[model samples]
Target chain A: MVAALRERVRLACSWCENAIGFIQESRLPNGARRVGAGTMAFRMFIIGLVLVGSLAAAPAAWAYSESDPSANPDIDPSDCESCHTGTPEIAGTEEARQGPHANYSATSRSCYACHQVHQAYADGYLLMPGATTTETCELCHDGTGGKGVYGALEARGLAVASQHRTEVTTQIPGGDEATGGMATAALSGYQGTLSCGDCHSPHGGGTVEPFTTDRSRIETDVAGFFSNQLLRRAPTGATYEIGVYGSDWCAACHSGRASGVHDLINHPVDTSATVGPTAFTYESVQVVDGVDSPQTVQGSLGRSNFGYVMPWPRTAGQGTHAPVCQQCHEDGRSVGDVASGRIKASEVFTVTSADGGTAGDNPRFQNFPHESYVENLLIESYDDLCSNCHHPNQLP
Target chain B: MTPDAAVTPVNSRMRIRRSMQILSAVLLVVLLVLLVLLFRELLTGAPEYPVSQEGIRPLHVILGPGVGNRPFFDGPMGVTFGADGRIYVADSGNHRVVVFDSEGEYLFQFGGLGVGKPAAGIEPSWKPGLFNYPTDICSDDVGNIYVADFRNDQIQVFDADGDFLRVFPDRNEPLGRGASGQDGAGIAVTSLTVHGERVYATDTYQVAVFSTEGELLDQFGRPGAEPGDLDHPNGIAVGAPSVVVVSNSNRNQVLAFAPGGRFMWSFGKPLGNDLAGLSGELELPRGLTIMDDGTVLVADALADSIVRLTLAGEFDGRFGTRGAAPGQFNAPMDVDEADNRLAIAEKGNDRVQVIVIED
Candidate 1:
């Protein structure tokens, strides 16, 4: 290991064109041996290379850690707040970026690690010269899997089989972004190209609800407004609001996909769910004979439709709940049997398409955010999804 | 070459000399440009993959994107070592089990075959051998691989060579007493750890124990706000004297239990942000591993460090910092120690860094 370190330091020195050479050997106060005599030692995040004295400690020497701070004092990146203080838009974002998206800190270069702030913006993004927006995200987000792999974020959300083409497009126009739609037109597909930034706020526009532990990223369960939709209210029971901004999140692009049998929007959206333990009423007022009255159909969440602990049918009772667009969709963790698979798309979507059969197989049949095992990104194909609300007990 | 060569020998010689001079001038310009470019490149501060003396991810192996035997991993959640000195990783994102040598070299993989990327175009099948999102993995004394099938609600067993062995505690068929105190099925098994004759698992809210032969050995825990009650439990381990410890991640606490499922005590407290978990404070602590001396090491994801404690709920010390570099960690999801080496499953870096964690 010491030999490898010496070679690496030699390469680093040679590459820098520095005339680094061994002046002599020395030892520190701790009696750790130091080889190679020079003026300075190269110390970094985890690298402790001695120039005048790279402390080639014994084989059992401890690595640099927080508890072992006394080992080396002069070169540790001990204090981040010393330089990280600023407006939330500036270095303050270092704390904001602490979610699953990866808390890039220290010599890893925090914000500048991904962005070349001073200059070298590529394709209008504040990234390094040659790196594209997708490359920056895929450095970790790609299926190879690291922290921010993106999904329901639950058990099933761990591995997304298919996902949005954030890499293929340039214009991430949606919701209220710079190029996103306005009050009337919130559809990215209706006009411009769609990318990841169109919906996700890298600086954490969402947070975990009051009940759950505090988290920064706006994931499936986190209840903060995004993409022209307000959803995922806290405390999963009756009275939990669904889609405060109208349950048409996916409808921004998918209200009507085609005209033939391929029409996407089948199940109703923005309606009160009849089954469940408790359900928040979307519209509390009922116009009875030209006179307004309280909500007519109060609902509750029941045992899950597909027999899983989900938002819709978790606790069963006589309460009426408002079902939103996400009730039948795949989350970061899709509602699937980890031992089996999610959605059973092979059994659900049996129709073979032109390119063969896209039983949740092709990227085209996949949905936004992430892919699903079934067609149209449905949690289950056809009548099975509808059973979560209508004909709850009739589902097999 | 005919009459022209005879007529203009002197003129041809002059023309050749002129051409040579023009070529020399162009060559000199090219050489000067090359030298200037080389000088700039040499003068550049650091190498392109910049890491100032951290020396580029010391002794790390990238578990990667279909780069040969290393199947493209989605998210690797769990890692364990077998008696044979081979390593087993739960490639959760790919819904498969990936095997590697003790040295972190890719060996082979199984599962992940479905209507997905690595298995796309193939007919989808919900075969029991296939997996959904297998979170954590462990190996019994005999090298039988046990996977915490997080979504499937079952523990799928496999042979050392990656064959489909029997599954434990039938799926959704109700374990022993659950957090609900009722016979509830379909518990999400997020993490797991193995002892001599038992396999301990954390199902988000409770700990379910299973025998080597797939029997429900015992089950305990409840969903409540009390210290003994578990809320979002993950990462479990069993000590020598039969102390079962678990990390209640959501509540940021680690609890210990007796062999027969008795609550011993709960340890863990968030000291302060300034402390950085160096004093054994926990922030979102998950993935518990026990040393030979019954020392417990908990990987605190949010703090980007590891908290060392004892089965008796004593705060030892801690190490690690916040970064994606060697000797540093970024959202370290899991940690396992064997053969005096620590294999860290880094959720942020998307790779397992094998480093020696000594005193």
Candidate 2:
């Protein structure tokens, strides 16, 4: 036995010595290992060299952790606060503190729960397990799996596109072909699965804000008023009294639209009066409505719709600005009346199509205070009224 | 000198005999050592696996899209080794069992998509044979093959050569407790280690264990994100002492369990290497088998590679790259280890690839 062991050791030593000699001979004037560029041939060579050995002998030495508790750390929102301070702190503000993501367990928010790091099994953007498929997010958003709050919309079945295609399977469009529909248009090219972060984000955009015209290239801010949350340093300290400027928040995905943002008026700057009125009337204000909002103008976000009390406040980059969902949905206090106190309201709009015709005089709605009288305006309680206007079945 | 040698003959003879015995013993010991080394190298690849490069001989085989006497069923689900040393393929597409020898020869076939017992007008090629999309297959110590009839949601047992051996428990009884139907799949018999005398299977939705008579013993691994959770557990294997290995494909990882389904450890990743963004690397690492040397081999389908991992969850390197070459595979699904050869059931290409471990 000792003789055999000795012989094995000698052989191994000789092999090692031979390898060392090869390495030495391969070295150039510089001391670094001569790693070639990333090419198929290079990769094949590396793989071949590594595989030229007996695997059954010692098994693999690389780590195999199907049950790696360490792989997924018990995420602490506070840990994220270091770089994500402004938003969460803003969310922590009195107006947005009660949302499920803000109040749930530290890691329970749809953000961390779904966006995992190092998801080798998933597509791009390391999605969490089960989250590998967009259906994973749909499990909660779609009605089929868990009781998804958004799933309630599917029950209405107004041509609701499968979340699968809108988020997972498809790629985000870019450049000239990049129709910013993912954010504003109801339909999507994404075919695999959908995740909450696909539409919303704790970081607003990503490393860089999406629609900022400013070349400074700052992280998308999802704080302050809806119009500026996802755009550049959200207009320092601009405050609104009547309503959020819609065009300022529509550009996140509606880059090609006349307004270059998301709102009823294609160019809010050019058609401001048309979008916002002294007495917010539905028929006049709804010209700004896009293809996604099927609920008509007269009944557009009627009193029954959440938009009645808290309208779908425009996000930053509406015309050339990037606005996050939180800009309009999470902010509980109206920019104009901070002292008026917090009002628990929603921002999802459900505007109907214009007239009976598929495209008859784009849905019109009165903006701000209006002299016109639409019975839909008197419904009261946006929570109840909004469902009528934006209810999934209400789509054109 | 001659006179002295003659006087002490008895002692001299005894000394010579003792020396001979010692020499023989030493030789025997050396021989045993050599044999041990050979077996260890062949199995463990030991100290360092696949001890030598000269010993490895890789082969790739494909099995279904449309060859063989009868093509695969709608779903080509699971494959397992029968006790009689035969490979039983659950040809879910054809709704039958495709039996083959270790050498890749198709011996005979049986069963078909049906709604009756194994013997009632069963046809190997037609529907009505008493089988419905057999998703998975397994074998016991006695050489009995258990087929997981997915659509019908039952386990049908068959003998060595392809004879029906009555379904263990009643077919009507829910095999996987919580997830009793379609999604409730992934079944296996627990060795004495996990439950003393019980059978274990995962509903893919929930985990359940049954007795020899097919009675429910215990259930665990609920579907959730918490520890001891199973998103989509597809395969399982019994390990030394009382460890159970469960493969959760959705999560792209594996879970180890104690005898009573207590959490042990988890490791592994998606099997595929394509980073095209659809999923992880361990792209559906389906089948798992523990060699006698305690090494584990995983057949990662999407990556089109056969991975060798240590019991402790370590990458021991891999064989079979991506391709249809002699040692490459498109989607190598399942594999079994016996003697010194690895019998891999390659699903995409349609034949079993054999790899010999020369270490």
> Top TM-score: which candidate number?
1
- CA lDDT, every prediction? 0.49, 0.42
True contacts kept of each: 0.02, 0.00
Best by DockQ: 1
- Point to the candidate with the largest lDDT: 1
The share of true interface contacts that also appear in candidate 1 amounts to 0.02
lDDT of 1 by residue, A1-396 (tens): 222245444544563343222212245557665632121222111122221122223111212233445654643343433454453323322222332232333433334334422222212244322234444454334321222343332223223344554444432223222223332232222133443444443433231211111111112122331221112221111123323322333333332421112333344344332232222322221111111111122221111112211222323322333344444544222233333222333322221111111223221221334444455445555544554344343236
Question: Model 2, range A1-396, lDDT digits (tens) per residue?
Answer: 123344445554564465456546554678755543223233333333432342222222121222344644664432444445566322332212111123222332323333332211212234322323343343222211121124221221212222223343333222112443333233222443333443333233221122211110010111211111222222211122212323323223333332423443332232233333332222113322332332323222222222322223332213322222222221111121122211223223222210100111111121111111122222222434343223333336
Give all TM-scores, in the order shown: 0.52, 0.41
TM-score attained by model 2: 0.41
Q: lDDT tens digits, residues B66-159, model 1?
A: 4554445554667787778777877776788777887777777788633211233434344666787777888887888888776556778888
